[model samples]
Target: MTATYAEHSARKRRPLFRRRSAIPGFAVTMGVTITILSLIVLIPLTAVALKAAQQSSSEFLNAAFNERALMAYRLSFGAAFIAATINGVFGLLTAWALVRYEFPLKSLVNGLIDLPFALPTAVAGIALATLYAPNGWIGALVAPAKVAYTPLGVVVALTFIGLPFVVRTLEPVMRDLAADVEEAAASLGASRFDVIARVILPALGPAWLTGFALAFARAVGEYGSVIFIAGNMPYKSEIAPLLIIIELEQYDYAGAATIAVVMLVVSFAMLFVINAVQAWARRLSA
Candidate 1:
């Protein structure tokens, strides 16, 4: 009987919960997780939704989709998309270079990639505004092109803040990608471009998309860094967050909430689509 029982135990799958776990059980862990999530995220979002719901449909639409609001949305989303795309391309190159080669000041450059994350957004905005102002060094060199106090400045700021997201996301994946795969592809008579397209890009697509989505989302909500450079001109360089602040300044709480809800929904929808695409890419790569 003992021999038979031992054989059966060995063949059985391991249970998720061990008889003697060091940590708490599933029920306690799940309860704590849910409670924390509710406190940090769900509760505030629910409040925003409820506040927006106080307004009638017409009022909500008027505040959320006004002409100025629409323009702000366009500028914010457009600049964010452009910046995220730029980051995706250059970030991939940066990651590849960092991983595949060694150069002077490599560590310094790698450390600098995370500067945007550690730097305060307001300080970043101020610094960028100063550097890109018409009389500033870089701005003077550009001559005829204006950067600060323009929509282009918004893109510049967004790109600056978003680059770290893409670079950090790609670096680990790039490092994990074995050189053997590329050599194998080359050995199979594939061209350099073919090796990249066939082996590297396919492996990196999902992660790239995830990084792009994160950058886009971050750029869309960015305020302090953009405002100084953007000049915050109405219907021109103004962003959605600035618009929300404007509404709030006038003590239009419901209107502000309505705009917030619109932004929330749009951001959520875009993220959902990006996540779906990422999932599709993963399946295709698999």
Candidate 2:
């Protein structure tokens, strides 16, 4: 019943992950993480539902479906979706350009993609407002530039804020897809369009959608940036979050909660759909 020196050394040299049982440390770590997330995120979300439930169904419906609330929801969701869609198409191209081909200033272009992340939202809002204003630089170059106090301004603000999400999401995916599959497609006499449509587009679809979803979600919740550009006019250009703030300022806590709950429900539904798509995509890839 004596173990050989080599056998003993081999046992000692085994990787930490190669143990007979999974690490108790991992379970403890995961438990703590899940608990913290629930407390920080899920608990507050539950509180919103509970508070909204305090009102009768009719009251909640009235608050959420009012003229001002309706306008805000339309503008906010509409602008966010538009911005995210634009970002999705252009971000995919940017990701591909950066990953698939090398050109001058590639590193600089990559760094610029993260500029939105580094820039504060309020500052970005102000800067965009100034640039797109009637008399401002970019505005002057293009025709009339009433962009500062318009719904178009809101879309621009959201797009500016959301661009980084799409770019960052697609970048790594593009990097992984480059060269090998492309070369294989090329060697098989596939045209550029054929390779992209067949071998590349399908692969990029899920990640692209995930990025679009992220950008849309970020845009929908945006307050700081959109407020400056959106003009915050009631029944006109105001967004849902801004409208919620208005209700809160007017001491209409129930009203605010009602609108918040609506935003919460819709946002959850959209993000859930996106997540399901992402999961389906991962399954397809696997």
Tell me the deviation in Å of residue 219 in model 1. 0.5
Evaluated with TM-score, which candidate comes out highest? 1
Q: Report the alpha-carbon TM-score of model 2 versus the true structure.
A: 0.88
Between which residue pairs do clashes occur in model 2? none
- Each candidate structure's TM-score, on Cα atoms with residue i matched to residue i, is 0.94, 0.88
- The Cα local distance difference test for each model comes to 0.94, 0.87
Writing each residue's lDDT as its tens digit, candidate 2 over 106-168 gives 999989999988988899888987888778888778765478778989998998888889988
Over 1-286, each residue of candidate 1 has an lDDT whose tens digit, in order, gives 9999998897686676758879898999999999999999999999999999998999988988899999999999999999999999999999889999999999999999999999999999999999999999999999689999999999999999999899899989988999999999999899999997999999999999999999999999999899999999998999999999998999999999988888899999999999999999999999
Task: Name every residue pair that clashes in candidate 1.
Answer: none
